[model samples]
Target: MNITFPHLGNTYIAAKVLFEGLGVDYTIPPLSSKKTLEIGCLYSPDDVCLPFKIMIGNYVESIQRGADTVLITGSCGPCRFGEYCELQKKILLSLDKDIKFIVIDEPAKIGIREFLNRLSMVAKDSKLSKAKKIKALSMAVKTINLIDNIEKECRFFAGFEKNKGEFARLLKTVKLEAIEAKGAEKTLKVLEEHYEKLKKIEIDNFKNPIKIGIIGEIYTIIDPLSNMYIEDILMNLGVSTRRTLYPSWWVKNTVLSGLKINFSKIYKESKEYLGLCIGGHARECIGEAILNYKHGFDGLIQIFPVGCMPEIVSKAILPDIERRYGIPILSLVVDEMTGEAGYYTRVEAFLDLIEGRKKLCI
Candidate 1:
């Protein structure tokens, strides 16, 4: 079956690894782009968060490219993510398309068990070499995870803009190179070689750096469009940045939440987010404010769709966080209407204030 997946940051890479490893027929919808966002926006309710648009784009793109099954994960929560796969399913059907979708409910940051099921789904009880497929996928996931870590670091270090977009491009290229190498040992060697090359590229972390925390709806925080390419804007301004949420965290929350366990851990992960239903990812975002203040971050950037209810709820409560924490948060609401000029301007102002303060500290 021709399979499809969305770009929820790392999962995009993981899905790629899964398909490649299993030797299954699949394709990645193009990376989240303006057109992708536009497709998502056109089909989705204006009130929902930007992630909806991103998910739709992947589904639509995949279907157009002759994809049969779209591999989606199930969500359970106040976060609304629990229903995303279902909602996207209806949306696709409404569009009058014939698409087969598999919603895997595997709960873990590793998603090892979940994705393996997809491979097995293709296998369909065929005694034909189950072990080989498992081994290949396992190795692929390991290499991909390693490669993802490097990409994250490169993206983080590339947060400083001394080298142009070279490092970020190299990071993606190296990941693709690893995927193509199709062997664990070759992937490792390529990683080492690239690491050496990237290290030699000069980047001054201290150059007018504005340490900032990215918060808000998960998709916008990770997917560039939903956030208006906020990270690139920050990098160009020489701001040191960190994304607060990732699939790993979500996977952990899913497993623990599924077991109805780890209340303390969840509360500790984001005290601001306690007492929220599964869909209420907003409260968790507030916890980021506290985390940032504790870690000496200069400012915070909150991203969400224009009418995202959960985030609007969080926004209502943010002044208290801003006041209590004494850190400025630049909350940028995203929609199709969000333009580059305004986003850059607000980001520039926020970075300027943070930089000015940093210089004063010295």
Candidate 2:
């Protein structure tokens, strides 16, 4: 039961902690890169969204490295992501009939009994006692939340750091160290130590950097490669950025949703614009844009894959928010054919526009 899962931001780190704690064999695929995208493109239907292709690539790459089981979360939303597991499984099985897929879905969608059954598939392979397995799951949850908080702080504080690139450098080092740490306990220690280090870095409290809110498709926004490392690019430019969608946030939202608890404040903000979930995180994107403006961000940037239906809906609605609030918004659509040079150029121009607007107000 050697396990592997596709990358979705820092979820890979949590996956490693979970597998190790469970005392099971697992493989972490190489970070998503040009080669990963190329392999995914080669095997995927040309019309499917970018995430599907990249995931196909991740699974194939892991398969070559001795992973026989793939684990992924299931969604039964209107977005195409809901169908990913079935399609991806068929795609992988065609290549290797012996491969296995375990999709962890909401108990409401798949029934509590079936949900436990799917989970047991992985747990049954673990040599740990039942209590130990539960402990591992708890540790994995803690790992994800801690890492996400660290990343959020680094990105938002990048602009205020007295030394340029300090936050970015520390962020890179923290991820590297966390990955190298032997087990769940050691990995948590590594993150906690660096998190303390992050606080000691000097910053200019009075410095007012161009603050931007990032909103878009979940996978594109969370996965750096999919969005062409837009967050890092913004960090380099000394821009403060905030994004509410993280893997940990997703986990909490899913659990709350299963319990019929409406804990998402974003949904309330989105009610005026898009009151319903039309599949994907479209409503959240709309809500985030409005919320950022209310929070006094200078601008907003929305990134999503080309031909993504939900994001396209959000994109169309964004201009209205821009007009009503008088805040600037930039939308970037990426695909296999997206060029780096042009993408960066547009981002630079958008920053320039926001800077000019700030100066005029001063």
Candidate 3:
């Protein structure tokens, strides 16, 4: 099984660690770029969401390098994501590309036995003993959590760094080094070393900076290409940002959800506005808006792909939260046709508004 999967932020890094540790033949698609988006647009339905098109590009790129199996998580919800794997499989097959898909869905949805069976398919090629395989899984989990923590710190601290661009540079360097490192162990070491370096960077806690919370569709918010690297843009502007969704957070949430346990306090906060899932992360978006407001965020930016139903709903509800708490919220919708100049202009304007609001308080 020459496995390949769609990129979800830094999830690709952890996937590399997992596949390398398993000693399985796998291919990591080149990072998402304009070329990737263009290719995806060429083949995908014009109306499909942005993420679906980008994923098609990722699969085609990997297939050129000899990947025959695709690994993706499944969702059995009202959201269109649940239909992605099936539609994507058909799309590829229609083009006469022979490929297989292994979808790892929640144990509660697909049942625990089926979940393990699907997972076993990926490791069946590995010669490692059962214990070693388990160890590899553990290592991958640790790698993801460690990297996410590192990224979170870098983003939040970017606003306070005494040396401009220090956090951004360190973040880029660490990701490059970690990806270049051979095995999971070495990758973990690279992260650990840089984390120590991160602590040594000078930051001024007294320097108050604009802080924003990012909320909206999971894929668009987490994947850099999808959101046009909004987080990086914020870092460059010396703005502190926070978001509740990360690949690591998703992993824990999925597990807790399967166990019928509520893992996030955000859900409780959102209940007053949006009481049900309504598909996608709309509930979480509303919840995060309230949570960020209570935590004293200067503003909130909600990003989602164009035509996304759930976020369209959240966009409407956000005004209520803004009025109720006097927090500013900006909603940006993106698709293949979105212009870079216009998008950046809106972001900059939002920042200007936040700064003006902050000055008024002082």
Candidate 1 lDDT by residue in tens digits, 1-362: 68877877656555555555566777778777878877888898777666777789878887788787777776545566767877788888888567777877645533768766664675453343768767766665565555556655665676565767777677668867765665445655677788777778777766645678888887778777677667766665555677647675666566577677876443574664456553656767877777777888888889887677788888987888788768888888877678889788888887778777777873
- Choose the strongest candidate by lDDT: 2
Whole-model lDDT values for every prediction: 0.71, 0.93, 0.92
- What is candidate 3's lDDT per residue for 318-360, written digit by digit as tens? 9999888989889899998888999999999999999998899
TM-score of 1: 0.83
**Candidate 3 — which residues are off by over 4 angstroms?**
none
The lDDT of model 2 is: 0.93
- Per-prediction TM-score to the true structure, in the order listed: 0.83, 0.99, 0.98
Candidate 2: tens digits of C-alpha lDDT, residues 1-362 = 89999999999999889988998899999999999999999989999999999999999999999999999998888889989999899899999999999999879988999999999998777878889999999999999998999999999999999989999999999999999999889998998999899999999999999999999998999999989999999999999999999999999989998999986789999999998889999999998999999999999999999889999999989999989999999999999889999999999999999999999983
Better of 1 and 2 by lDDT: 2
* Model 1 residue 125 lDDT score: 30
Q: Quantify how close model 2 is to the true structure by its C-alpha RMSD in Å.
A: 0.9
Worst 10 residues of 2 by lDDT: 122-131
| Cα RMSDs, all models | 4.0, 0.9, 1.0
lDDT, residue 45, candidate 2: 91
